[model samples]
Target: MNAVSAEPASAAASDLPAVHVVAAALVDADGRVLLAQRPDGKHLAGYWEFPGGKVEPGETPLQALRREIHEEIGVRVASAEPLIRIPWRYAAKRIVLDVYRVRAFDGVPHSCEGQPLKWVPASALDPSEMPEADHPVIHALVLPRHYLITPQPDADEDAFLARLDAALARGVRLVQLRAKASDDAALRRLAPACLSRVRAAGGQLLINSRSDLVDEFDLDGVHVTAAQLAALDARPVGAKRWFAASCHGPADLRRAQALGADFVVLGSVAQTASHPQQIPLGWSEFAALCDEAAVPVYALGGLVRDDLDAALAAGAQGIAGISAFW
Candidate 1:
């Protein structure tokens, strides 16, 4: 749901409607992202995107991602799921973009139709070097590891501190103190204690919902929602500033790039026990998606340490998963 309700005061604001689309976040081995130059005759020619295409009539977003990857690159995608959706307005059209992570597929990729292709590190892309559409995604591509510290509602301050210390000892570089059941007052009281530990351990801290906290705490960055990434016009804060987004797919990738996201987490790669119906895109397809990506991509969804080699081959900078990380 959109939060911006105010009409643009200028006549210039009402000229266009947003375009809706579906995109893929694919990667390959060796920690490099894939990028494809738009063919000479197509829209946004010479620009790049995470490979995949529009969701055709009657097909779901993942289905479209599968079809588009195969059709365009001649590889068969095996599994896939939601990454992020970015609803945006471009110069020529407005779009509601759905993006996905293609996990596995069959066959080596080749441009069935010729277009320029390159694999780059997520850390290397220069927004000024390309089209404007992927700017925010570039920022998102750089976010370092940020672990969410789980604190129970009933835990006492001492116990919470112990958990925080344990996490720091394990070399957690960043943290989000996400305890919803714990009230704001308690969190406030806990913040100083937690931050002291974090800083002593040489870690960065971020209060999940508070940008103000970033300033107040002398911390590193902010964690935002897909809505924030979608609505972002230009980065409102720092350069070399870290911002994380909960994304769904291409539109989200575009928005994240546009807003200058640090990095993003993409979906369940395999069928998890919790989601039997959420079938995953195995591996081949995942690599192809990475092939067209310009920013560092991580493999999310049902991932494990064992999947790292394959994911890297597919072009992800690293792996990101609820189950995979711990």
Candidate 2:
């Protein structure tokens, strides 16, 4: 703000050391994320966030989380693992926040500075009250991180069901049922059976098109293509199913956000749906798109199970693809 602060700001912003990985934990208990209010005089003070601190040089993010929790909250983080990464730039510097899910931890959390801490349920994680840097991280954490499953054209019902079962056995509880058959009648006829298999497997399904099917059948959701999202309207998400869409750039993401989409699929993060000539957005472009959205953006296109790590590294909610899950 003033000349003194401006000098330090210029210095901090310019030669930021190897982007330090800061670890944070969404400590959920009975559906709430544990939050600690930043004390006055600290960066982003007065804003509420998950308790965490910077990873010191030569230390791992997880180790930093454990030490920070103990130092700031007087509690040891028993265990923590990857949740998401948020690459954000403040007026002073850029930070690559490595978030983790702390499902196992000991002792009650308390702020050393005596600021209040509370467990706010996901349903109650009011956007207006959360710190700006945390908004995308919260969205990504709430999403199911679904695995996309596409049925092969002309594949038998039994074979399809087997794939469905295999996916479920591997702990996949969410899927997108995309069977690109040529005939309209065939796509229509295939819906009921496919929906049946998904429900039987105890997994939720999303149909890429056929809003009519969303009406006729009580499927889990609908995923609109990127084209559809661009010209999107604020239609009733309808009570029967969740509504989502596909997005690539900032425009598509903004449209989906305005349309009140539950989530969105963003893609070609790693050369998916290869046409040889088409190159993927890779990590940088993909992460920026993810940061722009208000809702979760699953990494799609050319993603396989192996790509999930890279996807998270790039700030995606998770990987989504016909090839990724299978």
Best by TM-score: 2
Candidate 2 regions exceeding 4 Å error are 1-25, 28-32, 35-100, 110-139, 180-189, 239-241, 272-274
Give the Cα error of residue 264 in candidate 1, in Å: 12
Query: What does candidate 2's lDDT look like per residue over 146-260, in tens digits?
Result: 6665755464666776777777777777777776563677677777777777777777877776576776777778877887676666643583356778877788877876676
Candidate 1: where are CA atoms >4 Å away?
1-19, 40-43, 123-126, 129-162, 168-174, 177-204, 207-219, 222-236, 243-326
lDDT of 2 at 271: 57
Q: What is model 2's C-alpha RMSD?
A: 6.6
Q: Pick the candidate with the highest lDDT.
A: 2
**lDDT of each residue in 277-323, candidate 1, tens digit only:** 87676676565555444445666676676776766566555565444
Candidate lDDT values, in order: 0.60, 0.69
Model 1, residue 162: C-alpha shift (Å): 4.3
Candidate 2 has its poorest 10 consecutive residues by lDDT at 1-10
